[model samples]
Structures are given as C-alpha cells and as structure tokens.
Target: MIDARRGVLYPDRMPRFHRLPPMPEAQHLVAWFWIPEWDLGPGETSRQDVVAYPALNLVVEPSGVQLVGATTAATHRDLTGRGWAVGALLRPAAVPALAEKPSELRDSWAGLSAPDLLEPVAAAMDGDDDDRLLRAVAIMSRWLAERAGEPTDAGLQANAMSELLMTDAGIRTSEQAATRLAVSLRTLQRMTHRYVGLPPLAMIRRRRLQEAAQRLRDDPGIDLAALAAELGYADHAHLTGDFRTVLGMAPSGYRQEL
Candidate 1:
C-alpha cells in the first residue's frame, strides 16, 4: 500500500518515524496516526524534509498542537535537540471537519479549531511529551470511532479523485485527469484545488514524487530507469528532473544516502 505518512524526502537523516493504525471507525477519514522522535547526540543536528501529501494533519507537539493544511512544496524542519510529535494524517478527501473548506487551510497550520476533535484531545493530554501524545491519540481514536458515520458526498468525490491521481500512473496531465474524473477541466480544477488544497495535476505529480521517495528509501538497490517507467516518467532523465524538483536531489544521490 502507498505510505499514508508522507514527507521524509531525505531518508539519510536517520530519524525515528513510525505509523500506527488509526481507530477502526476512523480509518476512512484517517490514514494512520504517527509518532516521530529524534534525539541527536549533543552537538549534532539533523534536517528532515518532505514533499508533503495532499492531506490535512493534526499535529501535537510538546509545545502545542496545530491543524496543518495541505502543503504545496517540499519543506524542512531543523532539529537540534530532542523533539517528538504525534500527528493524525487525514484521508485525502475528508475535510478536517475543523475547516469550513480544506482550501482555507492551504499552506498553513492553525491552532485547533475542530472542537469535537480537539477539546477531548487537549483535556486528555498530560505527563511527558510522549505520554501526552499517547493520551491525545487515545482520545482521538475514541472521538473518531464514535462519530456519526462514514464520509459522504464531496468527501467521497475528493477521495476518489485523489486515488485516481495516486494509484493510476497513466494520468500525468490535467486534461487526462479531467477526462478520467468525467468532469470538465475547469470543474475538476476547481474541486480539487478547493478540496485537496492542490490543483488536480499538481496532486498527481506530488503523489508520483512521494512514492518515488518511499521506494528509494525502502529499496536502495532498485533500478532507477525501470522505476521511472513504472512511475510514468518519460525517461530516466525526466525522473531525475522530477526528483530534483521535489526532493532537491537525483534518485542516485538519495540512494547513496541510504
């Protein structure tokens, strides 16, 4: 399955990252809950970067909590000391329930606004940073597990569009995606930009780069040429360029880090 936890464009950083299954009832709206921690020895520093996924994230750190919107570019967070975070990765099509429209949160991380989800989570958080995260996740699971029911309407439509862009490698252009979604290019653009925080074609490109990063991280020895073709790149050179665009390095450079 595609990794629901996006980012980490530089696998060589050697930070600890893990994904745990979300509550069963919340699975449709949440991909997984994740906890990542890093403790660089004294005088050491590490930078973790990711190209980001087209999903909202509710992140809780020792300092505070944030409702992060979909990001449009690769980003990095530099860490110098011990730090950790608990994050809930939203499903592609699900509105954060916190935002009136997902687009309203684009390129931003806001303080908790979804009372139904945040109130319980914050009240339950306490103790050590990791403990606070664990407690928060437990509360989150319960909250989502008991919600009215599955997502509907626009949520379904947004998710369907996202799955098409991520899983169907043949789609590489806006016209192709608009046809596949059976909507006019203009309509597709509007819906995706509003719902996914990215234009339809940009979402497709993001997924491709996201997947390429994971594949390289998992299997450093994989053939770049073959991988390029599998990911719908026109050639190895094209793949290299795409990787550079999203990750700041070519596939070989990333693999070398591994």
Candidate 2:
C-alpha cells in the first residue's frame, strides 16, 4: 500500500480517508486511488494540510470532475458540510493523454469535460452499501484505462524516471537519477517537465522533505541534525530551509503543533 498518510501533514485531523490499490486494468496509469468522506454539522469545517506527492490527480466530486496538477509545495483544503471525493493519483505514463502541458498546470487544477468518466462513478458513490467505495473505484479505474489507452515507449521511460526520483533514497541528485535510468540529463529534464510538471531534483527534494516531516512526526525524540544527514541534506540548516520554505514552519514548530 502507498502510505496514504505520508503526504498528509496531520492525520488526526483528517476525515474518513481510504487509500486503495488501483485495479489491474489501470495499474500502469494510476499509482493508487483515494477517497475521503466527511460529514460535519452546521458551521463545522475540517482543514486538511498536505505536502502533496509530485504527481497529478484526477478527482471526482459530487458537483463535477477536475484534473488536479502536481504541487510544488505544501497545500491545504477546507471541507465543509457533507462531502466526499474520489481521486486517482496518476502515473507518468498516463499524463500525456490527459494533459497537454503539465508544467503550465502546476499548483492548480482545471475542470474536465469527462462526464463519461464521472457519471457512473458518481452513481456508484451515491449508493448506500458496504461496497460503494469499491464499486466507485472500479468504475473510475475502468474509465481511465479506456480513456488513456496504453502508454508508449517514451511514456514508460517517463514512468521509470519518476520511480527512480521518488524512491531510491540513494538518489539525491538529477544526475544520479539519469545515470540510474540510463538516460541523458537533458532527457530526464524534458521527461519530468512534460510528464510530471516538476524537475527531477524537485521530485527528489519533495521525497526527502516528506520523509523528514514523517520522521519528525513519528519520532519526537529524534535529533534534527542527524535526521538531516540521514536524508542526504548537506546539514541541519539545509533541512530547516526546506521545512521553512515548503511547509512554512520550522521543524520544532511543526513538532510543537502536534
């Protein structure tokens, strides 16, 4: 399972959230599917803070469907009343078909005219049953598979680039990622920009920052300097700068909020 809560800053404050594996039909196009259902009383709202993963998301809400682009920094959303959202965290192979220029869509979203994808999933979500979420996800997955079709060779290469940059803790630089993927530095740069809307180094940094935040949250007694070194930051100050820039808070201040 993908760590559903890894990108989420404060899980304690989240509404009912479920992260599920993508259906076999959509595995190449989607990393995972996520759904968050919330029901609040009058005047109540839940604020969700997230240091989102470096990927696009196709989201289905009651009102409509939207293509959410990759985010460069931490972001948050406010939920009110009764609502739920079903989202697919898209893979690199699936990007080109859905978006023309991903880099332009950074830190934002656009409404999609995909009622063929939305109507059935929405109906499934509206059901009153134990299997509603499952049914909805399956419907969404099938639609994505059909709409995106199969990825080409270059698309698969983009997928490989993202995998290396986001995982492989040993990869701390774009050059290292290119070497591992057997691609030129320029190719790596173009692939990420075209498919992911972020640079290879940015993806690497996001992964490191996410891990640092998780460590601070999970192990309060952990030493900051040591954690920074372990995650390949040059020093404590580098890690602090990342936290301050992306999350808008210092490590200690984040820990204090817990």
Question: Where is the poorest 10-residue window by lDDT in model 1?
Answer: 122-131
lDDT per residue, candidate 2, 109-166, as tens digits?
9999988878888899888898999998899889888888887899888877877777
Native-structure RMSD, model 1: 3.5
lDDT of each: 0.74, 0.90
Best by TM-score: 2
Residue 20 accuracy (lDDT) in model 2: 87
Per-residue lDDT tens digits for candidate 1, residues 1-258, read: 455655676655747876777766676667678877787889988877778777788786656668788877678888878877778877754454556677778888788645666555655543555566656677776665565256777777767777787777788898998898898999888878766677887788888888788888778889999999888888999889987876778889878876
RMSD of each: 3.5, 1.0
What would the TM-score be for candidate 1 when compared with the true structure?
Answer: 0.79
